[model samples]
Target: MSTAGSPSTVDAPRTAAGSAGSDAPAPPPAPRRRTGGVLWTELRRGVGPWCGGVVVVVCWVAMYSKTPQWQGRWTETTDMLRSVALLLCGPLAVAAGCWQGGRERRRSTGDLLASLARTPLRRALLAVAPAALWPPAGYLVAAAGCTLATWPYAGEGRPFLSHTAADAMALAALGVLGFVAGRLIHWRLTAPLLAAVTYVGLGIPAYSESPARWLSPAYQHTYFWDRPVWWFGPASMVWTAGLAGVALLGLAARRRVVALLPLTVACAAAVVLTHTGDGLWRPDPATARLVCDDGTPQVCVTAVDRKLLPSVSAALSGVNARLRGVPGAPDRWIDGPRTPSPGREQLEAAPGAIVRRVGEPVLLGPREAQLPSPFGLAERGRVSDPVLYANWAVSYLFSRNCPGSGVDTPAARRAAAVNDAVNQWLAPRPYAVPAPLPGDEVHLRRLHGMGPAESRAYLARYLAADLCRPDEVPVP
Candidate 1:
């Protein structure tokens, strides 16, 4: 007989016969929230404090360190932006699941929840909602922060990251993926270890020339570079859809047979998509430029030069050889003008030779980046070319304030001046010329084709041949 004021059969008191509490507040009326109903509530309850803490900590550290500039620009470059997503989201997701998973148990409400035709899995899903939600939320926070940070640094008329929409979706998908993976393996020891492994694994490809970056569950947003994976947007929608199907089936399955198919197929597809063309596709150079046509933006290749192509090939070969000598060096590359290195002594000693670098960006303040030479020579040069008016300007500035590099004596300084004049006369405008033309004007062409050791020897030999004298070459 059902009584008007009695608890339902499933939710009845768990006593042997007549154990009763007269004033238990009616067991809070079954919580009014079902197993799946507390999604947003749990998400907010779980991730709110942690997100607040993260913002506070990141802001404090960044401010404390004075927020060092990256490559002479603000530290909001493309690679660092991607890192923001990874660092903030990946951990939040997994932690959210484990932290909130046992909420009911912690509050002594587990028995009541278990009686609602719910499995451990359904309740686990509720617990992990915060975990899933936090990563995406973190992405949004990071993206918004980056936009504000980069706004002041925009070039010409190009808006800051025209493809901001694509990037946001991509980050959200990756965060969701990470949160789900964490919820699945909620082991105390394994969760953190798995999170770390996933973090590193996803990062390797995103920074590489490979397409594996698109498949990574950690990339939330991408700059408007012409990477093929960006064409699919950041959400990795196909993969995320498949993952959702798997998660839903995983929730419903009661036995091994019922669970195997969707998961196995989904996982296999993921693996294939991630590793499809590991060593195959090569992105063309000149693809890094941003493009715009009637509000339709795309990443497109701009120009190609075949002149002195051998030098480009030789530079790449040298890089590969260096990587072979050093373990764990990144050997792959996207062919382009190399960005100038900062804060290091010149890696190559040939002063007249243009140092060619691929895939690096030209940054501000190149003069301060110069390193002290091994010899007591005070190395000095600011203009891109040291063989023309730029050379003369640098030479005049150096001789006035500092002794010339490689010039041990006053006579050597005089001789060094002679060398500079001849170099300027012969090369005319070394700074204005592109790398290909710059190297050819100063017999730096001979510097190529030779191996590193041989190239050093040739630079010495070329310096000895002074076809022109200082008195004959007038100061500009």
Candidate 2:
């Protein structure tokens, strides 16, 4: 065994394995370059990339136009992109697809393409790929850019990827339909007319308060904190993709009967979409939950907006300072849609009234952010005019369920003027405060002359009295 030039057991086994492995046949090389060449030809030669470029440009511009509204929030970002996909890119994609579809007919090459070895389905898919896929690619790019932009400022929650996927499917479906239309009709004006009709058609259903509006991918959403039902995105995808599949199959498949399956699926999806309606959305507990900052007269916003809490707190800092130790001040200023709503009549009243909001603020003199609606937030991201809005919010709190809602009589006017003066003296406006009607100057001077503790005491008494009855209001 140990004879001269004899191999050891380990070396012998290793050599044998190496020889065996080397003798085995190699795998076929992948046709990567060929596949790439075909794709390059399709993208480079066709109208697909051009259509995609148009989408990129339009979506980028639209997103930047309203950057402040959506940049700091994931929900806003996703919804904004969804709107762009449906309204602008969608129509353009349809027109482009139709134009692309007519190319083979214009060149008289339909017969040539058919004569090729590829199956009808393969040819159809290959031909339709450029038109249908490009718009979604453009959208994907825009979506990525938007998400990256929002990353720095976003407060909470991930982007609604399902919404984005559904939106892309919708664009592709529209493009597919337009392609089929072009194949059937060769008129040049047909594209423009389809675009116009489709645009109008999308809008017409929106005016009707029916569930059909929900079937459109462009339907509006009001709340950022609400999430779609788990199946909504999948349902939307199925509905659109199914319709597209049916259209493509009807146009190119050898057997037209194959279209029936997709047609049936689309119908079922459409039914589900129609029946669900607004019920598709529900409050996301994580986003809707209160996130409060620790401060006397604490400030709170939804957990989804936690990052913006500091800004909100800063906005109300001056007002909070005034109300922190006051005997009749609200313990916290809560901002959210879920803030308990006042009954109808009380909700409608004017400022300087004894209104109870979320308890213990007997005097509405100092509450802030009673209504944290997205409309208001969108108008001013991070509350652009915090001092002014803070002042306004405080004034709004005292407005509920009081006879002071109307200043019909001269006495009521005087009471309102005094209330205005007290509000101004408590929270100074950034700009010159307008003198209240019927002269609040005298009361304002009296309050300005008092020490801080004494002034707070007088404010307590004044707020307790019925400001609507001039006789009952304390002379500061």
Candidate 3:
């Protein structure tokens, strides 16, 4: 039945074999695809480089712009970085996650992708990996930048990597939750709504007075002398991971009841970890211990303020010399109290110790100007002008300046008059002479008339009197 050019059956087989052998070596069997290559390609195509870039940029800007305030300590630097991550990066992660989750729906590829052999949960994990990983990676990059920036200025402390790690985990969990939300809802506004809700949720705990505020990750600011417990970071990670797990299960798993187990266990562990009286952090001995100077009438500062030890020591030396033989004279100068307070420096007195906080101004000033003495009458818990002025006079001998006790009572006026007269007698400068109050004339006259010897005797008497008992403080 074949034509002459078509040839017979034996010739047809030979021709087919020749054609098959000649067809580009069968295209090399299509190069055998690998799982890693596919996953990587999916990650690159889905998230895009800009997503990670934006995260890194935001984190860098947030941390670097505020570098001046947080550069003094590793704890402060890391704390600020964590705060920025919560406030800024957390929301960004949510939006990015939502965007990533909606990719299939946006491209109308959901049905096509569903037809693939991979299970839904596995596919979801692969898709969610980029969102979950990039945010934490961005946080770590920012943390590392902050750590490096703080290294030159930071003192006496190591970076708390556990805190940063917990923060990274929390952010990743939030991203996963957002991805799940996007998968379930398929709304365009979900990203912004989730962001708003997250910000509000974080803000509520920060502003609230209840102990339950501890549930918020943003509430974990490190106290000045304290460090978080070892378990606290892990507890936060587990709790957040549980939340993310529950959300993932809701989106990807077939059984909802079984999914709650991880959340329940996580909540229980979080409760147990945070239930201790120490709260999230405890005083760190290394950062809180007294760092003393080498000299008589020992000068000591908390380890965090070791840089100020020299100035504090020099300031206390003159006062200590003046009070060498006096009763009730402080034998030690300590930096503030054992507790932490924000922005306020208090000077306190114990039996033989005088504790005064070294503020920023003092730390930045010259050695001679950093006088943090405990000689003000208010410092001794006395409110009377005469007692205050007498204490001021003793302090003036060491400080060469008015105490400016900020008391405006009649007694204070009289004390000021006496102080001016004494200052005039001692220095004879062209300064404004304060007019003596009616009863203050005698004290002023006596103070103005004292010679060096009489002044020494007067100072001894003033120093010996009990300023705490205002009635017993003798007025010269």
Candidate 4:
């Protein structure tokens, strides 16, 4: 009772050091680390995997459908598959990327993601990686499967790995670019708009005649028969990588304006690199050079068509037998200059060579009767008259000398009249004629019934007649 309030406090057990009113705060818990589980969850739920699967299925179907076209040639198979993949997958990947980027905005998660300790660039990369990577991965998987299937039937030349890689890179770059666009533009229609734009941009170059079309990743008009310079693959890869890099840099940069510098430089470099020369590709010597048969009446074909050499050689040898000793007759049989197609075969005359197509039907049927004497006319059952074909052949081989104008002209008409007259003299017999001829059947019969000696002399005079001077040409 002597010390009052101070004596009373000391007497107590002196409970904890802070009495009952302490106000100290506890330390905050540590931030969560970003993990692969998150990435997997995103990939599983996002459009990337589904889009990739769709792309794979589409490519498989397309490749299977065109099996007849590519089965004979390895380079063509790979090149065509790669081109189709690029054309279809590129647009789909871009659309997928756009949808992926727009998902966050649609969910209103921008603020939430930004508030996390992870940097925005890292967030973007993690989010966009699945879309950017999956399409190309799917494409490669499909390509591998296709190659394996076609391996047994494939023709000469190995697959062009460099071109395939370049195409894959371009597809990835498109996906990344689409992601960036989606992230920047918050419109609901951005995904479809971007996809349409990308498709049109890529497609225009394919149809365009300009050399600058090579700049487009989707502009793979060059076929397997030709090859670009060695530098083309690397240049394309660099250009596409640069495009993707610019998108990434732009997303990560603190200053938006500075991010454009790399993009601008890359674009200029790409233009220069892609514009390698006046043409996108040139003939490959290994494929284009003549591979000749080891025999008389030498038969030659491009290396790509070597598989058909045996049949081609046999066919041309028959034609050569009939053409022996003729002035300006072809000494060698070579593949004609024409676009490759199935069953659409043709032949043309060249200096010292008769250029014909492989697998042509002209080689089949009656050996002597179907042998095209000139301009590829034959005396098969389909012909209206054998004499008509013979006379046409003679005039075409000896007299006609105009370039193929592909239109009706005076020179062509006059040449036709001379052939008709010669045909009447040779065969007075008539079938289901398409039109009436100038001479009567009795007169034509008299001319046709002539003796062998007189007939041979008459034919000599007829063949020697000048078609240009129509009035002077002999008629029945």
The model with the greatest lDDT is 2
Candidate 4 or 3, higher TM-score: 3
Candidate 3: where are CA atoms >4 Å away?
1-28, 45-48, 295-298, 307-332, 340-408, 412-476
Once fitted onto the true fold, the runs of candidate 1 whose alpha carbons sit more than 4 angstroms away are 1-37, 47-49, 52-78, 102-110, 117-124, 156-191, 203-214, 217-230, 234-237, 240-353, 357-476
lDDT of every predicted structure (CA atoms): 0.40, 0.76, 0.65, 0.62
TM-score, candidate 2, is 0.79
Model 3 lDDT tens row, 149-268: 666645567888888898999889888988888887878999999998888887687777565677777775656577777888788788888888888877887677878898897788
Worst 10 residues of 1 by lDDT: 369-378
Q: Order candidates by TM-score, high to low.
A: 2, 3, 4, 1
Highest TM-score: give the candidate number: 2
TM agreement with the true structure for every prediction:
0.46, 0.79, 0.68, 0.65
- Encode model 1's per-residue lDDT on 276-367: one tens digit a residue: 53321224334333222121111111122222122223322422333232222222222222332222233432332222222122221322
Task: Find the number of clashing residue pairs for candidate 2.
Answer: 2
* Model 4, C-alpha of 356: deviation from truth (Å): 11
Question: How does model 2 fare in lDDT?
Answer: 0.76
Q: What is the C-alpha lDDT profile of model 4 across 113-206, one tens digit per residue?
A: 8998787777887889878888888888888887777666443466667777888788888888888888888887888888888778888877
